[model samples]
Target: MGMLGNTFDIEQIEVHKGPQSSVFGSNAIAGLISLRSKPITDNFQSGFSISLGDDSHKAVKGFQNIKISNFLKVRYIIDYNYRDGFRNNILNGMIDSNRKKELFSRLKVEFHPIDQVRILGTYINANLDNRYDVWSPDNNEQFETYTDSLGEDSQKTQGFSLRSKMKINEDFNLLFISTRSNTQLVHAYDGDWANDSYWLDEHQFDPDSTGYNYSFYEKNKRSRHNDSQELRLSFKNLVTGFYFNNLSEKDDAIGYLFGGLGDQADGRYDFKAYAGYFQIHHNVAKKLKVMFNYRLEKNMYKYVGNTYDNYYGDDLPLVNYESENTMMGYKGSLLYALSDNSNSYFSYAKGFKAGGVNQEPNLNEFERIFDPEFLTNIEIGIKTIMNNFGYVINAFFGNRNNQQVTISKQRNVGDPNSFYFYTANSTSGYIRGLEMDLNYILGSNFTFQSTFGILDTYVENFEYELIENVKTRAGDRETAMAPKYTASFGLKFEKMDYYFLTSASYKSKYYYSDSHNKRSSAYTLTNITIGKKIKDFNLNFWVRNIFDVKYTIRGFYFGLIPEEDYPNQLFESYGNPRHFGITLDYGL
Candidate 1:
């Protein structure tokens, strides 16, 4: 959802790095990106914002908040966005081949039953209509397209959450949270890049053997829902928490020619998980403090081929399993006051992640089983907040065992786009990294913030390459999708009722495939914004990718055409080009 970051309704975005299993869960292994919506105020508030940009991009946002009474309040938000693709169809001059449309709404209410109790309820609805049109092997330009059929990726989602806090005494409180969500997706694509006129001769030559239909199309789909609950109790020096979640998923990935044979691969998956945790903190001396946390977690999974509501089993019986696994997670930390403006912390944390079932059937006899993953982390960091400036620096060492890796299936001739993915585990790996974040308030109403991350990784004992069928030597390469370095810098200037901000971000080259030879090039992007506010009204202008650099974010190696049967070649998707926009805002 990075594209939605430009929306004016978002108040703040929080990034939590490293393994957070002691608090959040297994999904927060690498890191966590949290979006905090703009909070509702006590008095009445209303606002609207509009934006227009290049590529026919447009957006609208509006919100209202009211205090209904002394005991209750309500807030509502609505957002809409639309953008034309950067490239046009060479066939019909259609400019929106990669177009995207998004609509979202949210309702929130707060209740104060008494002096010691508080409750919040929220409901949300969202829809995304995205079109897919990317590159073909024959084309080298960023905006060129050669596919025959149009593709679509559409999703509809709805969810709700409830949170409550009860104050039991002067130094204790209880918290409860529950959430539910439902989602469905529709995705289809052109399996053959070229039109029938280009392949007519090859098809007619082998009609008796290949049949009459050769043109191809494919679709992969997902429908899933989940419910979860969490409870916590906090005291002066201790806290305890328990959480549970359940998820059910149904998937279909199928392909077919115009009139030829069709292949079907469908499955159902169910997951249930439970976790309990306890934490305690104490100050042993005037300038020293320590904390400890422990968590016990269990996860279960069941898979069948038939259906989500009707589980009768597939005829081929692709893969079936009912497995339960449990592990212990722990964390310990010590904090010392370095000076009146700075503090230092040392921490050690161990976390566990449950293994999951493979979505695709096994082509070879490797059992298609992945083991649970584990991580041990040790960190030493310092953080300080002074009147004019603040900075945080951290050095970390971590070991990840049984790291899960996803590999793309080897491509065949006729089904270039109908690819499936499966997962495996690395025996052990080592990762070391340094991170720094700095924010400074300048003398002339100017502010600056910058963050840098440098990482080094090695695969220790991995000896097998699944897709390429090769033996991997020690220290041969790093893990896939792990970048070596990333950095960002930003500057902000505000005086009176006006503000201007600009930022630049960079990421180093990284590997995507585990045959592990294919990699993406490093890239940098810049963005700037200017806005003014007057009597609850605001106007803004922004520009993104000011230099319009060409870069790729994802890549895969694949083969095409049954006639020549060539070796695999790299195919990639490019990032967006330069975009500039202006916005008018009220009470925002």
Candidate 2:
């Protein structure tokens, strides 16, 4: 789903790092982010919030809980947000090219048949109509685009989940959960960043040139459905569960390729998985403890694709592929207590991910499929609390085999406009990192927190075919999005119904793409919030990126225009500029 209800509805958030697949299934090789919403309460409560900011930013959210009876309760939440784009389009005189509009609603029902049993059902719907014309040919300009066509990205999603918990007896507990979700998404964009006149003037009607009056427009419709169920039983330091999941997705796209040629493509994918897992904790010594977890999963996947060229009236061959695999993951940890408030732990985990077919029709059979990836992580950490201070430090190393990597390349040599992307398996890779967190509380009114981390990642013995038959060895290189170092510090003070918070974060330069050596410069951001409470109302003011730093979030290296001899150059999408906002909340 595109949106996860409203942030105000969330009660808790948990962050787990390094190889969580043993508990969360696949795609958790690095970590997992878990969010839990507040439960329905018997007490009647209602609240609303309004926010306003620069760039025409506006948001409103409200929630209410109603106690219908002694045994049942209902809660509903709704949120609406709209913001004008920060970027301007000089070609069309449009300032809302990257606008954002969103609507979200959630309904939850709770049933308490008895003291030992509780059931909860929740339904959520989200609508997003956002613009995506953020790309530009000139990075020197400030938040401006020259494209003639404005892009669009929109989604409509609906989801429902049911969960029940029962205490069968003093020694056993049962829990069941089921969820269903579906999303309809439409995305369209102008692939070429330049205007028609610019391209025409560059190529001078040269049919042999790929950029000759180049016009590229692409639109895709995606529909996805997912269903999952899980049953769990817990008994004194031991937990076991069985899970089943199914997912189906369909994508239909139309592309206005070079010279306005029409290309149509359709693809469908299905995935199903079943798994059983168990976790156990035991005390091995007076001051030591041990924990173990295991999971076995079987998964199946299928892909079908068809392509056609409408302008040329040519149909491509159909593609149908199916695959199945069985995988196992496990985690083990040992904990030792040094004092009543201090503890140390060591952990090891194995994570697994399944591979599937590629939807692209332009690749050969060998390039259309990739192998699964595996990660084994080992970590040692110490956590301690001494009076008003607490700290945690950990160091971890991970080894991955058959690592899946994606790269984009031109279909033909020197034809930069024919770019296509695909995923492939690397022989091996490794990552090592150290992280530390520290917090201090003083006088019950002032608190300070800081975190620092350093990471190093390298891929070994990996090579790819840059063109039809030209193999290019990609020597040992650092992983994309892996910064060398990161640090953050925050301070908060509260007294007399008022509070103030300030934080600063820094990150070192990092590679932006694994396929190339394009890197982004190091940057830092600062944020501050001040709030005051008056009776049942709360008012707050916040400012983010106070320095107005222009940092890159994404970048690509390719040839686009003739102004620079069509030489490979860096194109980047930047993060948001400085933003300041005010919010008011009322509760009853």
Clashes per candidate, residues 3 or more apart or on different chains: 0, 0
Positional deviation of residue 26's Cα in model 2 after best superposition, in angstroms? 0.3
Clashes of 2: 0
The 10 consecutive residues of candidate 2 with the worst lDDT sum are 410-419
Tens digits of per-residue lDDT, candidate 1, 85-174, equal 786666556789778888888899999979899999989887888887775545455676656778778777888999999999999999
The RMSD (Cα, Å) of candidate 2 is 2.4
Q: lDDT per residue, candidate 2, 1-588, as tens digits? A: 754435767888888988988899987877888888778887999999999999889999999999999889999999999887788887788878889999999999999989999999999999998988888866854998877777889899999999999998998999999999999998988777758665666445343565344566778899999999999999999999999999999999887632232388888999999999999999989899999999998989999988777777877778898888888889999999999999999999999888878776667778788877889999999999988999999999999888888776766323434666788888899999999999999898999999999999988767787767788777388888889999999999999999999999999999887788889999999999999999999999999998899998888887765543557788898988999999999993
Q: What's the lDDT for all of these models?
A: 0.78, 0.86
Clashing pairs in 1: none
